[model samples]
Target: MMDFDVELIRRYAAENKIKFGRASSKAVIGKVIASMPEYKTRVRELIPVIERVVEEINSMSIEDLKRYYSPPVKKKVKEEFRLPPLPKAVEGMVSTRFAPNPDFVLHLGSLRPLILSYEYAKMYNGKFYIRFEDTDPKTKRPEPRFYEAIKRDVEWLGIKPDKYIYQSDRLELYYDVARTLIDRGYAYVCLCERDVFKKYVYNGLACPHRGQSIEDNHELFDKMLNRFFNEGEAVLRIKTDLNHPNPSVRDWPALRIIDTETYRHPRVYDEYIVWPLYNFSCAIDDYMMGITHVLRGAEHRVNEVKQSYIFRYMGWDPPEYIHHGRVAIPEGVLSKSKILKGIREGLYTGIDDPRLATLPALRRRGFHPKALYNVILKTGLSSSNTTIDFSMLAAENRKVIDREANRYYGVRNPKTVYIYLMDDVEVKIRVHPDHPERGYRIFRLYRGENYIYIDFEDEKYLEYGDLIMLISLGNFRVGEETLEFINNDV
Candidate 1:
């Protein structure tokens, strides 16, 4: 059933709920007959049981009637939730990607875009890619280990991307694009200091570097590639309207030199000193990689405006963009800086610590991928910030585990009891109450093998004439001392 149908069904399925204008089940049958009407997912099977319950109630003794009818537990259907269609999508040709920095393991917030991108790609029979945006080594540094860790986390979630890439490896491509723009006078090498250019751009005035000849700009840009310019000595700027409202967008920095001798890239080492910024590399890669659509958080909406200038200057058709609001888990340590610090200070064991909201942490806790699908699709493609709790996911997780996980019994604060069977008999136990088709686990109870364990907490009512069920094994009545085997009804 759809999400809207779930609440109505829940109220109808409540204990002693009326089905018609009044009660539907007969006086003797009670609410059990009405129970079948509330379960639309299992209506085919429940309908037959309703008729059988009505037929058998007349002959059933009052004692048996009390045992026969109890409300069935309402369950979340295993079926996946529905999501809205992608805007302006072209089936079989549409492509999407989840581009993440490999600085740390992905957290729950990352799933919002990652799942949406992957599902949309699968929905359109198109390609999904994972591009590591690992260009900034000074501040948001990338580590080699997290490269594989991120991929492993994605695999654990059953996502297989069609392609993978790293922006750090494409420095030459960014350099080549920068050269083309400089030669065409769409971009120029700025010699002005950082504060100097900010004042010029924001004041609706062009810096001296902005009005340089095409040859001079090309010469300086080639010098930048050849390491002739020191860090912060020069930068390539994409020319935009100085009078634009967002001054940072006007003449945005496309590429800049980093002092690799002090702050080195993990992969490239000190080989390259210059790197493309987020807007530049992203737009260029989106164009080169034929990324048809971009699904990212709404915080990047301004970045889209910045990137559009590069695409416009290059006469390239930019990818379609969809921005969503942030996804937050309040109890989670989502900030990468905080997480890294926690690990360094030994506050957390690692990225997969049970306290974390990282994908690895969730996987380690036995969460099913269906749990994530249900939660994400319910919050699908919206611009509203969402706060999620772990229990919300665990509730959906139990639905799947309840049907599949095998039965195992464990008791804390144990109490031992000895019982001698009248004769050797086999005790049969179904693997799962809801799924008897999985078969049963059988063990023969020897006449002399009489010891069993129960929780000491259950010793509260240990008196003379009381019956207790050993789960699926059998029913036993308490005598003067030991629990006596009465019957195997349960």
Candidate 2:
């Protein structure tokens, strides 16, 4: 309508300026037209009128622009991460662990738990440990090299684990716990077909073999441990409510026979046949290792609930669980499967590819560890998921790198510029303008053939009579294939 307020466009553009560092006129016009209910149907004709008003807004003086719109000034505050308190007293006896599967190197997502565990341990003056959960040798198989690679990544993050434990090395301990559970009438050895069990579970009924006696279940469990039962023939299920609302929590499978002869583990190749599932093994370790606190993503709350059953069965109190929302980089690939596939298909150079969000990639791209720590600490344990832009991370990194990284000029598509001069001149340029104490790099321009190469990037923006100043050198005006010195004043 002719009475539509046009000042709304400038107001919206100023709000966007705080977010994107600059207001886009096109974006402002589109937003203004979309905001009007009557102009929705006449977008084609309204666009030109809205665009013309936006143009006028863009040409306003900076001071006048500020009068219309400006971002609020935020007072700086010291960053202090607020994590939930541990359930029990931490009298320097607290122990925490970072259990990572060594299938691939650590990434940004992995660092979330790692940093939380490590920092909490240090905060309480307690011990920190690193545990490698490499039980799944078939699907997400672990590699031996990744064991050391993960250790290196943890150390690079400035975390030093007091103890390192491998799940493969503790297979015997899990077997002992499995035997205890079977003999205590808490677990049963399942020999039913996969489809048959699924039907029973779907109907909220226990399988026929769930009624087996403790002695009979013990025999089947021993048979499983000794490899008498084939991989798909048997599994050990924890006795839980079949009619539970959550089907996944209904009689969850604790251990299954993995035919290591076919898919061998890198650490203990073909040595064990029976393998414990995630909840069972993780719960058992938490109890055995005296872990006081567990920090993980909210996605694993199901695991926490399942592990509670294990703790109840064993007559032990489970550790405190702290769950935070998941995080992702808006521009980088954080998925492990995608990262591996990209490297295999030549879509990425490796895990260290700048396009990926792995620790190695960020390290290669000149990101300081403290900068990443700052971002994560600021996020804290918020329940909402975070999808931060890559520019935000880069801005944080620039603050740290700016103080240390040396300056260097890279010429792109260079073109020769001849300066007709009578005498040679030596120009002294500081290595870093702000850091003059570092030293100077001297450049000598020849007397007879006074010529230098300028990047085409800078050349393309200049006109025949445009005056510019080269760093540490005097101002000069662009001439026909030559630079005419205008003034040598400092």
Candidate 3:
């Protein structure tokens, strides 16, 4: 067996644990083999020695590892939340996707998934994707501009997706999957009335049409694709246990007919009538795109549970899920319908309205992407819902822009003040108080009468003989109608 320093291995493992939160034996062993020149010639015999070192590292307690790896001088560290550990299986091959409906622009709450997926993908040196879930062309009609707008929004956040996909372009793939499910007796066509079906679903009972033969279901499904059935006349639902606790999982509807003529799709107008719902299309895409991990809102937990039935019937392993809490802004609206209505009603501007919490609006308001990232990183992945007041966002944003934003003075409802100067004064004020290298604004007041403006409202607080400092200039005395200079001590 090749010999190695036991103490060195312990120290290295401790440091690795500090960095990765878990001591990886493979990494530790590889590091040892690379560092020791003797192992180059005896690589085959080093396994036993490496295994012994691995056991030693694994035996170290969390407290011992932290104490061993900590810096000598204690300092207060930032108490920021971090993403929980990723599954070991997704280490190098991690792939994540952000699916956005192109009906509207992305909001602050939408950034949670985009940031998490992109960050996690980057953390593992993996791939990130931007998939437009614009399959619903009727109820959630997608605008042509929003596709590009959403892309620009993600790019503005400094996240460039490795791939871009549109569900409309992949209709045939979804159709084939749906057909396969129907043929395998795992899905059926439900022609029952919409309201009646809902009533049946609520009671954890299957509709009468759920017992349709696979052959009949396949024929009806083709008719659905062929546009023979009108909207709401029929729907395709996946097979699940009738007595399942969650009524949503009891043979949930997968595909439904939509009248594309009225609410036409921008990409593929009137091309298809049968469109997949959120769960089915999303689950299929997640599997088809090789997504290893899914980071979405806790509101999608029901979707996850419902989609698991599809994955099980299709014999595909579902991706690991990380559901975070909802982020609400009390001062800003989150509803897309309400925002759009407000825009139409002339209550606000477009998507970049300052009152809105959209990514574009925040960008226009001088908020940096790093500040948003910091806020999201601190929030981490928790199922507990959170309400983010505007002040909280302002405080976070202030930290990012305060260092660079230039300073200026302004007076509202201004009135002129004449200063009778006894001497010339040169005033130099740094553009940014924290950064002098950015230069200053200079004001040269010559000996004579000089005029400056102050708010008209300030006259109420002033008295005739009172002395006042004209900030950056000098002190002056308030006269009966005009101001007189006292000294240039300012």
TM-score of each candidate structure, all chains considered together: 0.83, 0.79, 0.76
Which scores greater on lDDT, model 1 or model 3? 3
lDDT of 2 by residue, 16-41 (tens): 54333334565776567556656667
The candidates, ranked best first by TM-score, are: 1, 2, 3
Over the stretch 403-482, how does candidate 1's per-residue lDDT look in tens digits?
78988667677888876566787877777767778888887777653878776645654567655566555667787667
Model 1 steric clash pairs: none
The models' CA-based lDDT, in order, is 0.78, 0.81, 0.82
Identify the candidate with maximal lDDT.
Answer: 3
Write model 3 residue lDDT over 1-490, tens digit each, in one string: 3355766677777766555434556677767765674665675676666666656655665677765566557464654556777775466799999999999899889878899888889888899999999999888888989998998888888988999999999889989999899889999999999789889988877789888899999999999989899999999999888888877778888999999998789999998888999999999999999999999998888898899988998999999998889998889887888988999999978889988898888888878887888788878787888777666677778767876689988877888877787778889998998789999999888788888887665555567776666666766678987788777665
Provide the lDDT at 218 for model 2.
87
Write down the lDDT that model 2 would get.
0.81
Model 1 / residue 476 / CA error / Å: 2.4
Shift of residue 394 alpha carbon in model 1, Å: 1.2
